[model samples]
Target chain A: MTYRIDNLQYANWSEKIFRQMREGGVDAVHVTISYHENFRETVLNFEQWNRWFEQFPDLIFHGQWGSDVRKARETGRTAIFFGFQNPSPIEDDIDLVEILHKLGARFMQLTYNNQSLLATGCYEADDSGITRMGKQVIKEMNRVGLVIDMSHSADRSTIEAAEISERPITITHANLHSWQPALRNKRDDVVRAVTENGGMMGFSMYPHHLKDKSNCTVESFCEMIARAAETFGAEHFGLGSDLCQDQPDSIVEWMRVGRWSKEIDYGEGSAAAPGFPPQPDWFKDNRDFGNIENGLRKIGFSESETAGIMGNNWLRFYDENFGPQQI
Target chain B: MTYRIDNLQYANWSEKIFRQMREGGVDAVHVTISYHENFRETVLNFEQWNRWFEQFPDLIFHGQWGSDVRKARETGRTAIFFGFQNPSPIEDDIDLVEILHKLGARFMQLTYNNQSLLATGCYEADDSGITRMGKQVIKEMNRVGLVIDMSHSADRSTIEAAEISERPITITHANLHSWQPALRNKRDDVVRAVTENGGMMGFSMYPHHLKDKSNCTVESFCEMIARAAETFGAEHFGLGSDLCQDQPDSIVEWMRVGRWSKEIDYGEGSAAAPGFPPQPDWFKDNRDFGNIENGLRKIGFSESETAGIMGNNWLRFYDENFGPQQI
Candidate 1:
């Protein structure tokens, strides 16, 4: 065994997509359950997922541990893991870190696209790193095994989070800015800071983070991963497709505006194309994991290294980080 | 051994009160953490209690089960159990019944002193009984072991709750309306419906529920209990106190008019006296449990019966009702 894991996705979930995950042999996917919802609203989302798990028990199950990936393989089902793309689920309460973790949230980004109570987002001009509550929440998250995700955070905040977290944090879905020059993508220094602290970088398949938007080739994407592997070791890379499949353009507005702004914040998109950008043809949905795997092998990566990039690295990271830290 | 459990209290909690509980040999207390707060505000209240438990570990600890009373006795500390006087902490979501229970809420009233989403309160003009959501919430509460408390609900609602709930519900702090006709007290049919269905009724120490307000005698109170024992068995009764010790009048206003009213709603108090009523001399604080014990004995009760009313009855109830139902 090697495992196929897409560590990030916010799809318009349906039976069709769940079937696609099974067809793709995707063992586990870290699905974003909340973007800007508050605690009660996020719980409603969990309740909705609970209904989904009940309705489609044979197709999918709620994943909590790394072993669940192996269990999913044996059972012939896809394991869906929960995460938050924003810290809004916790509001201002530090104790909710433990509460939400107990409710099966494994990953939470400190910010989304603006200044949050915890940390500054990449879109903010002044990145104040982490706030006072941020440090306390990080300690609590470390204690409770809620993995810190700085995927949408500023460079300073992302760097500080890697330094502050006792457990290895993650940038769950983004590419290198050195490759695409997108604001959402991490710079070389930011990626190095995270990987140096034993964290993982998940290559995103979202068009905005690609080399040439939706026109980017699999060759270019694989080459970027090859460069990252040479710079930061192969064990620190995995796929976090950020696959927002089948979601409407209005959903993108909710993700970007989200009750915080009265004006539109066309994050990564211009005024004309102000919606979720189209995915590159090579990587469109869950079934495209094979294309990326073959591309990695074609880019001069050995079998073991390709296995690590495909999913085993995330499985190892999950085994080590998704529980209370040993004293 | 007999346990000294006060099943209801909403005090201005401090080291002084905790020490007083120890002086009275009290083992456990189900403290009201929220009166009318929504889910988030209620969590803030729990956080405050968390701080208190941290600051005074030797004096108090968070209690979740009947066994914790024994643990408290062994450790020589008071085990503080959490409760909500209204269903506001759960908002309109039925799933929060389990969420709040996991956060250590042992009891929750269906209503306060006004009409709630679940049921009609005592002060309401008509008793419409339990709502459709109330039936679902009762089942959820039963499954999760969060006891339904109808101490502030109207007579019809109380009776309906007892009929609907699968597990034993509680009137955590109230008295018999037959003895003293107060709005907040339970009527004969209401008390009978609860106790006959294996529920517990905790006698209130609030002056408004007494025969002569603040001038009520211990002998009179004990005689009322003796009659109640004959009517509804000695095993179904215990002390709740309803002791709002050291709370200011402003706190009472918040309880009675928590974002629900524009004008003042004094609840049990009148316009002339809109604050917490004075406690009788016989039972002013936790240090006075001995007084009630003596009075019960003087009123022709046996030692075991006196112990049962003092706390043993509640401990037995806790043992049976504070865990997931046996399916």
Candidate 2:
């Protein structure tokens, strides 16, 4: 049973997208529920999702465990797993790690794009690694089955997270810097540190992380995945997409600045293009997943390996890591 | 088996207090875990209690249901039930009613001596009764089994809450206005509205609510209880000591001021006595519960009625109200 999953997406969600997921045969998606919202604000986000689940029960449902993926497949619906791009949802409270997990958040990044209370973000000049609270939060997150995601963290912090987490840590959405040279992309050593600790990496489809930005070809994307698989094993790779479908440029501004700056931060975009860049034509939305599948096959991935890259690896990882660790 | 439950207390809790509860044969306590804290700060308070529960497992455990009282009695430990003295923990979000309940909150007052989003507090000059959000929150609270508490609310709002709530609400800690006429005390009509709707009132031992402040006699307190029982029935009454044992004046100041006021508005105290008033000699601490038991017995109350007032009545209320409502 090949299960298609996108481990990261922050779409301006609608029924159209839900239908597109079904059209794409995507069984589950780990969706960004919050970026810089505090605990109360994040809860309001969860409440919004609850309303969505109720309003569109036949199209989507809340996904808490791997079994929910199987259930979604059986029911012909998409399972929406919750995640955060920053530790801001937990605020400064380490105990909120468990609380947020109980509220159905599966992934939490220690930093977004700046120095947080827990760790240094990739944009920071100095890489201070993890702070005292970061270590404590990591242990609590491990205990409570909230996966540590260092997708936007500094090198030292990401490496330290991979080592400090008793459970495997993930870089849920990023490519290799060796391939794209993007600041948001992971370095070879960071990827190796995570993958060697049995963690997974989800290749990003966001244009900034690609070789030629919006003009990057499907062949090139497939070749990049092939290279990552060759280096880090296919089981450690999956799709994240980072799809921001239908979201306006103001959303991008919010993502980049997020009350952290009074002035705008361009992030990966330049001053002239300070907004979400267009996706490569071939991978436009959920329905374009098939294009990548064919690209993988044309690039000579075996059927099982393609299945693993598509979703099976993440499903397995979810099964193992989304619950309290066995004593 | 008679259960000894204090339905309200906000003590400066310590090992000493827990030991004193055991010495007094107290099985359960609905303790105020927050006064004006927002959701995240309230969670920090919960975490503090969690640490205490861990540190003194033999002395007390987290109580979520009436059965915990029985468990406490059998194990010779006290069960600490969590409550909030204000609606601030929910912070204008109706969904947090269930979230806080899942986190073990059993009681939440609609207001705390100032106008709130939910209702008018005693100190507020205008009584607008239940707000639009308050009505929705009441239904959600009923569905989730977080009891509506109107202890610090004004007359119109308290009456409105009793009418709006499908489940029985509570005046967790206050005395009768007819007995002492304090601003915080419930009027006879307010008490009738709650009691007639099957709600319970926990008689307070706070000096300001007593007949003669700190010098009020045990006999007078017991006689007042007798009069209340005669008027509202014994089953609707229990003890809520309002015990601020060992709390410093600063804590009392915080309780009264919170972050709402720039100026000191000494609630239940005058400018000359802008702090917690001294408890009557007869009821100074948890260890003094025995004195109330003796006074109740000496006031010509039957054993069953005395037992009910001591704790059995609250035990019954907990059994009926501490979980999700029946479909």
Candidate 3:
């Protein structure tokens, strides 16, 4: 029952390397859509998205990027859906929402830690609770099937979105503030709001992402995850594990700076956060929770709970909200 | 003993109007420097401000904008100095704190009504709580001399600003929310915070702005004023009628829309407000309590309290916060 899912991927990922996903035990890749169409030429166009489907065949892609996942499905590409780390690409265009959703965007984080035209991002200098546009976006998202993600947004903006969003939101990737206390982490209210609203919460394994990465272990991640599950009731929670298995340090730097766009940085000289111990398998070792099974097992999740933590809970969520179109 | 003062206006307006004021029976004006302005404006924009001295020679202008007021006073303009609103308008630009303090802009309002880059505005969609930016704004405003204004901001933003602000903020132009549940009005906590913080509260003659304007008479205005004064200590309350005279219906509609460029509304479309029939001079009728003077009488206020409500209370506030600078 513990269906595994890794919620995101970067632009430079390769088809040949991900062939082991079947062995990696990941059931679906919840891929985010990029505003930039030229994603490393590999994921450059619909052709790459189609190629991934042809190559993996059984692999399911939950798209956040702009891909006709269903169209790909018609061409035998497994369900590649769309997601957005920030709602900016949608801009003020709510109608584009239906077009994107129909084109297959499944998840959206309201902001990316800075002020957008819609709301203050989590990392922004000012945390204006939410903007008029943010409110409108949430309502529209509910009408469409775009899931709200609070992973990188500020607590105030996230909480506001949670209260306003009719459909439960999905925290695509976050840690517990109690465990990590990083800006990227979620507060108890945020998790409770999301889960209480019948949404999903995900835990990432960026050690630098955890509080004391110096002492961070899988146990810490689990403790954070389990605590939130206990607080909001376990059924509403799951894992995203923002597992950037092979993303380079440059990409990491790009992520850190690019998310905010504003040049004002307190950590101008500091390296990218929660840096990994230089393991031989640096990419897989530092970024992911673990290499598949060992990751959850080391995190001390019971098999059934681990199942829920992996993809089962997400599958159930997808089924309840958008799966089967039974509604 | 009933001294009249306007709690809001730019710094030099006093000198310009002071000559006319002695004729009109006006004593002083609570001159506000916009919190959003740069320090250079306060410090360098002295020539025009100095012109006020020659014009109104005897009229006193309370400097609520920032530090430039001190310099203005030093150069011979009598200043009752303080910051009028909490938000520095510099927002997360905390560095501007000392710079503006050096310029003399002190008083601030936590927010306007919708959420700002710093805090929630009075008319926000939800009254969640003090945001991180709001909390920071309060601390900085207090550290400096920014007075927090809660007249047109959100309830939660007001509450948070009150609790968090080091110095007490005044409800400079608010009616009792108990009388009418408009966003511009304040609650009992407002009374407590201002009084407790040793700040002042003021009543407004904004009949059109009151919650139940249709039912509003001078009696109702008096009731609201008295309730707030009593709830807080009378000593901590004052009169800031927020009276804007000589504007056209278009301007009224502009205020109604709550925006300079955008025209949204202040809520409650149909209500009896002070209008042309009784007009500005309408309150002159009832000597016991019907007239503005009578309204004070109906409240059973002593001459001192009457004077304070009439305007002296605000005078005391300005004189207290900014007067010590006078050699």
What is candidate 1's lDDT per residue for B1-327, written digit by digit as tens?
778999999999889999999999999999999887788889999999999999999999999999999999999999999999988787655678888999999999998876665676787655557754566678888998999999998888899899999899999998999899998888889999999999999999999999999999999999999999999999999999999999999998888766543356677788999988899999999999999999999999999999899999999999999899989
Q: Which candidate should be chosen as best, given DockQ against the real structure?
A: 3
Best candidate, TM-score: 3
The TM-scores of all predictions, comma-separated, are: 0.53, 0.53, 0.56
Candidate 2 clashing pairs, residues 3+ apart or interchain: none
Off by over 4 Å in 3: A1-65, A68-134, A140-147, A152-169, A175-203, A208-327, B8-23, B27-88, B98-104, B115-128, B153-160, B178-183, B209-232, B244-266, B270-304, B322-327
Task: Quote the lDDT for B56 in model 3.
Answer: 55
TM-score of chain A of each: 0.99, 0.99, 0.79
Give the Å shift of residue A178 in candidate 3: 12
Residue B41 displacement in candidate 3 (angstroms): 13
What's the TM-score of chain B for every model shown? Answer: 0.99, 0.99, 0.72
Candidate 3, A1-327: lDDT as tens digits: 355555654435566445545445445667665522211221344456666656675554534432333233344333445567766455434456565566566777766655543566776555666676467667666776777777777777788787887777778777788777777877788777777878887766555466565356555556666677677776776666565556666655555544222242432125344232232232252124344345556666677777777666777777655421222
DockQ winner between 1 and 3, please give it: 3
The candidates' DockQ values read 0.01, 0.01, 0.04
Candidate 2 lDDT tens digits, A1-327: 999999999999998999999999999999999998888889999999999999999989999999999999999999999999998787645668888999999999998877665677787655656754577678888988999999999999899999999999999999989889999999899999999989999999999999999999999999999999999899999999999999999999988877544356688988998988999999999998889999999999999999999999999999999999777
Per-residue alpha-carbon lDDT of candidate 3 for residues B34-152, written as tens digits (9 for 90 to 100): 43333344454433554554555455553543243333335444344444343423533555665565655545665554455456666556554565445555666566555667776
lDDT of 3 at B163: 77
Q: Tell me how candidate 1 scores on lDDT.
A: 0.89
